[model samples]
Target: MASFEVIGGRKLSGEITPQGAKNEALQVICAVLLTEEPVTITNIPDIVDVQKLIQLLSEMGVTVTREDEETYTFEARNINLEYLESKQFVNLGRAIRGSVMIMGPMLARFGMCKLPKPGGDKIGRRRMDTHFIGLEKLGAKFKYDSSDEFFHINANGRLKGTYMLLDEASVTGTANIVMGAVMAEGLTTIYNAACEPYVQQLCRMLNRMGAKISGIGSNLLTIEGVEKLGGTTHKLLPDMIEIGSFIGMAAMTGSEITIKNCQIQELGLIPDTFRQLGIKMEFRGDDIYIPTQENYTIETYIDGSILTIADQIWPGFTPDLLSIALVVATQAKGTVLIHQKMFESRLFFVDKLIDMGAQIILCDPHRATVIGHNKQVSLRGIRMTSPDIRAGVALLIAALSADGKSVIDNVEQIDRGYQKIDQRLNALGAQITRI
Candidate 1:
């Protein structure tokens, strides 16, 4: 239902603006159904899976116009497509795993799309078989009813692009096969593609509405088959896993925080994986700052070994921020090992950080280890619950570096992806109440 409580050893400071980019606004709000002209988008991250895919594109009519709380203006001219063979878009498209990327722009503009069975963040077997094997290798035709689970898909006439190769590298299956190879008709070579900046800002908003992609940020994508696709404004790109969970909640509450407008070079390798758990980042121009330190040590591997951190694919190191780098390596100073090679249950929430005293070691469903305790025994708060969405904001950054109160029941799985996250960590002072 609703719970947060928090309170812990607080220390927070100021600047915090990293919203907009819930996985690139669900692949740029399904690239506004591949354009019917009028796609305004902006720093949109009023989360809940991007407002349930903009309320399922206004229940499939698409014209969503807001322009304020983080802007919007979609306008898929007049789409209803029988509400994608409704049961109410299959119960609002099974609560968003990016609503299966609206079957790649509704099978590239209404060649039939009807999906269901989608939902997100169980953190495990998330496989729409590479989004229907790259939209059935761009010719589309993937049935799977199961008496009404639904995933029908079709491409009745025009959809010809070719060359695929993607077995993995599926950021929403290469953004639903680059929104069905940008209105497929000709060239489309996607090979192992998933160059995420949310698929390079959905290939630069489908090349400013006129698709022709071309190896953006690498992994080889090259769309170029446009017959239609118009409106464009796009702007999202800040949430590098909520700026690596506010640089791991300002190094597990030593807090000096300064995040603000953080586009700091698309945060590759997430500030060197939290400086290999030593914290202290500084970028300034486009802000990252994060200072307030005391200890933070953990760096090893030049041969010394014992320093794992893992999670590759996209300048590597973002398996949704390795659960805020394993809760900022449990107050770093020593061990590391996160691993989490593409989810198994997202390290089973580190047994609620080893029941709140923190010394982790699950080392199973995709590795864990942690073991820092450098704050030397502070974490004490308990009653946790949140299961998914990056381990519920990594158990709300280990309940804001625990020490006292810490309720956190579900919290709607961190508000389906943090946006008003306890009112922006209560303006950087953070007590987080949201009950």
Candidate 2:
């Protein structure tokens, strides 16, 4: 288990560019399996989860060439479908939730695929029903092996297009269904689809590769099944989660930092959500410049009530950043409620922050009330363990702004999502040592 040894109370400055979106990279990289042609992708984040997915694909016999650190060309001309039955495949597939995505493309093209119960952050119960159900609507059959916890999915000939109103607008579920529907025989309409930038990028990339998809940025997507898809080059957007984390770090530590090339428009409600926490930021071109602030006050609702920031679908506050908001609010001037609707266990990390002297009330499994100290009191760092990726970075931010040293164990959780996080923050003057 890797750990981060951080000395807090040091203000950092300088510019840091966000990595290519991890969420987007996972989706599009799996889309390569839908075609035999070479799919070149740039801006892939060099991280553990992404690497695990790429290695999984390679073991499945997808020819992967690394053009650069962030660019890869994947040719799925001769995928080894037999590998799916191997115990080795199960070990690799169980390491990342993104491994579930390969099912759609593999089944769409090769007509069969198997997956072990996928693994990711233990935030809460992440259901795979949405993925399986949506694909079932497109004429796929699924069977579960209770003994091995593997899903066996097979398409009945070529998938026939149909309409599906998703139970939820799950990003991965929607991406999976879209990939499965792209090569079906007729028109497929997906209502209540995820319209996040990552999903939109996947749809656009499919279009570029000869698939016909409409509704590039809306919940209602229509896909006219093409006979086949071809090769295309795609670039991933900057990770909004990382960008939000950087914003929180800047405010918490009273530092001035510029986040460059942030693809500001695609960030949706992220900026305003942070603004609601009283963190001030300026948009200089495509860069976000956060100035040093000794104090920033949380905003009240329109009726002068305490502010409540809840996570919702796209165009709403992202559930992923609620931890960052909670951490940033620790030093803000007013009170706020963070409702983490998507994951029940995400707020459990607050007990660690409370140990460091932040006043936070864990209302329940999904909500917390934070009483900001307004920087009148600095958090005293202590030893802690990272429970998940977002919570890990949130703890790191808290440690950075604390008065003393802190040790964060299981930092591999953070590295799964954030690429070279300690090194990147260190370049901007943070004292984070990997031990």
Best-matching candidate per TM-score = 2
| Per-residue lDDT of model 2, residues 264-326, tens digit only | 999999999999999899999999999999899999989999999999999788899999999
Give the alpha carbon lDDT tens digit for every residue of 341-399 in model 1. 87788788788788888888786899878888889888888888888878888888888
User: Residue 162, candidate 1: how far off, in angstroms?
Assistant: 5.8
Q: How close is candidate 1 to the true structure, as a TM-score?
A: 0.36
Would you estimate the TM-scores of all the predictions? 0.36, 0.99
Candidate 1 lDDT score relative to the true structure: 0.84
Total clashing pairs in model 1: 0
State the lDDT at 427 in candidate 1: 78
Residue pairs with clashing backbones, model 1? none
